[model samples]
Target: MVGTAADADELLRHVDERLPDVVVTDIRMPPDFTDEGLRAALQIRASHPTTGIMVLSQHVQRRYAVELIADNPSGVGYLLKQRIADVSTFCADLVRVADGGTVLDPEVVALMITRADRDHASGRRLTPRQQQVLALMAEGRSNAAIAERLSITEKAVVQHVSHIYDHLTLPPSTDDHRRVLAVLHHLSR
Candidate 1:
């Protein structure tokens, strides 16, 4: 059972027919490249209560990670594809999933934990202005809107945002929406 979510309805038909042990899938797929694969996995697990589900992704998408493990944590596994490059390790993960063992990749685990600590530690490190800026950024506000909110110039907001990005070790990019994902990842723990 490996496919994108667009075909999941049809795939679920086949899965129902075949009754596979575990459904391993990526988190991105057609019909909107969101967490479609994860949703499909959940649907499969819901319809086929006995089936175990394992999800794979290149990065630790904490949002999907959280949902995938929402139920039957012991029977669900989330692994980074990089961690499964080795055939033996991948086989071991499959065996573990088949036997209802949660197989989280070490890197993903570390990232999830570290992000939690970072979110907890952030308040103590950021200044009041920085905190305001972060809240606005999390809200998908533009630098101009953030500046207006703080009664400052857009230039100042841009500078503050850059400082925030630098402090967070995030790449400097105009599309600040990525910070929302970063915050979600941090707060997810």
Candidate 2:
């Protein structure tokens, strides 16, 4: 509600003038209409690390999602435009991003999981339940949230996370966010 811009350049200008808690932008913008918004979003991320970003796309461009979260997975999101129809969920996603949580549309998460399974042998080692847990993790869901969604206990979710880390060969980290980023990076490849 702070301000709006027509194109990527204007968007950057607005951001430079006054940074917002979260920025929601399209993956495409005016003029070239191809990734201009994403480029601007990257620039903003570089300059304003505290500000959150959410990139909306009409199509599920897995590459763009990967790119957006490549350097820093926190306070970022990539969602399909259709997600906007579910206003409550969309608002929740924005708030989550603003609070330094990564958010990926479920469809995007599914695509990444599918691609990972096809491309990486390690991905094939996971059970369907583990894959579901991993997908929720990639969507920035905490163990409690994942457990609620899966109708399981938090301990079960924790065990699944441990197994996922072992299967993916991720090193032990005190930070959960780093683990999520590592999993996402693995899937992106």
Candidate 3:
């Protein structure tokens, strides 16, 4: 079923009635035009356990991504509004979220990686090459993609990822969004 709300309160009210399988909302909506949608999304996540959330924004706001995926990365997705232009890909992402998968826009991931590289708590400890691999990982790239981007072998990419997890002190997580969360956790510091 599909429903619409003008503001965060209305959205919550709608959710209170019956949770939808997925929610696709813009980051800036209603009342304040600031983070109302993001705040509301978080509330929904806290209140409704089964619903999936996909937040869209014109700009890549790292904080939104971090907060949404902070506790549980599953059933969550954050994408730039432009992604909607490619209807097939956008719908596929939403479907992935509904299926308890996590999807993050590459731009958002890149932004987080860039910010983390500058001031993340453990970023300084990462070798520049490791940092690049982490950034590509944050972008949801496969080991193959990382290797192709860096002109390194897939085995090397795997090694870099292991080191990134080690340097960040991330206890191994099977969560699909672990890579993105690693970047988010760094930026959160």
Can you write out model 2's per-residue Cα lDDT over 1-189, one digit (the tens) per residue? Answer: 789999999999999898899999998999999999999999999999999999999999889998988888889999999989999999999999999999999999999999989998888899999999999988888889999999999999999988888888787777665566556756688
Best by lDDT: 2
Residue 142 accuracy (lDDT) in model 1: 62
User: Alpha carbon lDDT of residue 74, candidate 2?
Assistant: 89
lDDT of 3 by residue, 80-164 (tens): 9888999998888889889877788888776776777687558888898987887676555679978999999999998888888
lDDT of 1 by residue, 55-174 (tens): 889887766766765544556777788877898978877777777665666555555545655667754465668766765654335678678888999999877777766666677568
Local distance difference test values of all predictions, in order: 0.67, 0.90, 0.82
Compared with the true structure, model 3 gives a TM-score of: 0.81
Q: Could you arrange the candidates by TM-score from highest to lowest?
A: 2, 3, 1
Local error of candidate 1 at residue 169 (angstroms): 34
Q: Kindly indicate the candidate among 1 and 2 with the higher TM-score.
A: 2
Among these predictions, the greatest TM-score belongs to 2
Instruction: Give the least accurate 10-residue stretch of model 1, judged by summed lDDT.
Output: 178-187
Task: Estimate the overall C-alpha local distance difference test score of candidate 2.
Answer: 0.90
